[model samples]
Target: MNSLFPILAIVRKDISVWLRQPTSIAATVLPAIAFMVILYFGAQAVGRNPVALVVQDSGPHAQELINILSDSGAFKVTMITIAPQKAEDALRQVKVAAVITIPSNFDAAYNAKKPDPVTIHINNLNLDFTNDLRRSLPAAITKFYADQSAINGNNSPIQIRVKETDLRSQDIDLLRFELVPNLVLLLTTAGIVNAGLATAREWEDSTIKELLLAPISKATIITGKLLSGWITTLLIAAVVLVVGAASGYLRPAGTIYWISTLVIVLLIALASAGLGVAIGAASHRFQRVTAIGIPLSIDLFFLSGGITVAAFLPTWLQTIAHFVPTFYGTHALQMAIFYSSNEGLILDLSVLGATAILAGVLGVLSLRKSMLA
Candidate 1:
């Protein structure tokens, strides 16, 4: 109880200091908010594309084709008209990605079993948009043929069927999928900035000498500092988790899954807090610690699969990401929150637990050495 008093006092003092500093709080929270805003806008850009559809044939077959294209959930058919020149103008002005025309001979070709090509003029500006247009057209056409086969019995030319089986109960949208990493980023920033600033403040305010002279052991000081940061991070994380759950982004399977999520979050906060202590002790200046901590956390966020899946990255980049602690953190979080499965979770927890221990030890040693120096 006597030794614990110093640790508790240190934690209390550091947390009080953190609460008094508004800049430190903003520095921790704003980056995660900014990233969420960026991802929201990015999701809009990559969603369904706009295209022009020119229908020259006033036949039932053409009308059916038009309905299929509109309902395919791929293209936003911005303009539907019989005017080829109008489509040309829209294409030239970059108003649409492509001009798809169902020619006058479409009905004639179908009745006579003749080959009639539906003309498409693509903007071909970039591969992403270009490929989207290319793939969507074929899929729409396949659906059209499938419908025709159903109506006309064995007379239809092509028959292709696709049956899908989903591994999970729900589909995670792009924005929601990204929310996990942003939450991780928030916890990491809070942990590092809170603890780092607390440690650096001692040097900046000329209070390190007092701490060195105090009756508390160096280990107690380090533990107190880390606990303060970890506690602060967990508070921030709680708010984030509540918001995430209320917004429908995070849905744990049951009590066990919720427990798993909390464990992962706790380990992440501890590891981040330890790293923060090391930075603060080594830099010994408020500005220097802030500078180092923010950029380093951001880099770790990206390397740990920020907005994109690490598996889809270049081979060397994926290899580097595996070395990052947050890679395991991110993977574990996604599994628990989204998949509701424990697959590969053991490895993730093991890595995070080990990292927390190693970082804590490094932080303690670094602060102790600084105290002696």
Candidate 2:
């Protein structure tokens, strides 16, 4: 159709514009990286936190456990030979993260092979110590002794080591949760630029009029603008996704799952662009655009559940959340990118696709005023 050329030419010019304007590229890429990088290091430090310990042990095995805990360097072990009353006071005042009490009968329990039960008093919620330190000791020592005994022909598979991961998504720790968030930022920022300003900017600068005056029908001109923004947003998403996958963030959740996620993210960008155009076209001032667009952009991303959970909200917020595309997109992206949640991918795809279509229609309808003019 003679109509299609205007759209194509518009898209071509848009890409060329961005390529020439290096600031545009930096704006989109740098902010997402900053958001992700800041949190990754923070989470790593928090999760691997060191603790302080108060030990009340003097016997050989007690000394051995103390030495092991000390050499492991997970905690700063303090030698507390003080009165039990003093130790209790110190613990109550939060002077230590945890206290280990080895009963005077500890050696009796070890010699009787009944196992010495060391009481662990924890004042903090660091489960790493619970899961790996106190819990791991008996098994580790048993294995160590058993391996030594095996050299003497004891012939017993007496000790076993079991490794467990966080079981969240993709065997990645809470740290890599950054990928989805960074991507969402990428989507939303790009969406606002493409949707809010791209089409409207052209119209404002009289570029749209020139194109319209040239040969493009009003329909093709609008479609081309919408498509241009959509392609730009998606192209960035795809590049980040490829980098994420190669960086071990992509981590094939499932073939279908990944495909659907890709579709939904693109669709969300398109819809967001349409909403941007509708909003931008309605106003002539950048201040009004930011006033209206920035708040909506943030609200949509938050509603998307990229970082927050909808279930935790009061009923009304969650009810309104159903209207948010990022809510569905994030939920779906999580499934496709991390959990490989199969059902999640399909549900997200359908929801996002519907939104994209609706938004595109809105952008097209937004152009009716231009047509009339």
Candidate 3:
């Protein structure tokens, strides 16, 4: 009971100091929020490209094809017109990605069973947009043929059919998929920054000597500091989770999945807090600690597959990611909340648990050395 008093006092002192410094709190939270905002805008720019449509033919067949293109979900028809010149101008001015022009003789060619090609004036600015435009036209044409076949009681010339089977019950959008890594980043930043700041404060204010002279063991001091950071990170993470759930981004299916997600988050926070303490002890300066801790957290986030899936990265990058603790943390959370599956959960938890123990040991050793120095 006597030992617990000192630990609790240390924890309370650190928390009070953290609350008094608003700038420190902002430094801990803003970078992760900024990353999320920037990624959200990037996601918007990648989906549904804008294009122009020019219909020179007034026939039903031409109109049907236009309707098919509009409904394909690949292109946003920003400009629709009868004049080909206008669409060409829009394409030239960069108002649209491509100009699709239905030739005036399209209906005649179709009726006569002759070849008719729709001219597409594409900007070809980049392969991503160009490839999507390239693939979408063919898909639209295929759908048009199928629709015609159904209406005319005739076989469509294109025999290919694609049936998609999803492995999971729900589809996670790019923004929501990105939120997983962002959440991990937030936890990491909170843990490292808060704990690092707390330790560095003692050194910066020349209070380390006083702290060392107190009638408390080094182990208690380390435990108190780590626990303070861990509690702060949990509070921040809870806020983020609540916002995500309220906004309909993170939806854990069952109580078991929620429990698993919380466990992973707790492990990540504890590991990060331990690392933060070590950094703070070694640096012993507020500016230096922030310099190291913030960048280190950001770098870990990228190495842990920041916005992209680790599996889709280059072979060497994926191999490197496997060694990053945040990689397992992100994967564990994603599996728990998004897929609601226990696949690879045990391995992830084992890695996190090992990392937490190793970090705690390092933190204790570093703090002990710093105190003696």
Best by lDDT: 3
Q: RMSD for each model, in Å, please?
A: 2.5, 6.4, 2.2
Top candidate on TM-score is 3
Off by over 4 Å in 2: 60-172, 309-317, 370-373
Candidate 3 runs further than 4 Å off: 26-46
State each candidate's clash count: 0, 4, 0
Cα lDDT of all candidates, in order?
Answer: 0.85, 0.67, 0.86
In the range 109-171, model 1's lDDT, one tens digit per residue, is: 977879978888999988978888889988888888888888989656785468899987888
- How do the predictions measure up, each by TM-score? 0.90, 0.71, 0.92
Candidate that beats the other on TM-score, 1 or 3, i.e. the better one: 3
Candidate 1 has its poorest 10 consecutive residues by lDDT at 28-37
As for lDDT, the candidate ahead, 2 or 3, is 3
Ordered from best to worst lDDT, the candidate numbers read: 3, 1, 2
Model 2 C-alpha lDDT per residue in residues 113-186, reported as the tens digit of each score:
78567666666556654564455446445654565455657654464545687656435555576467557757
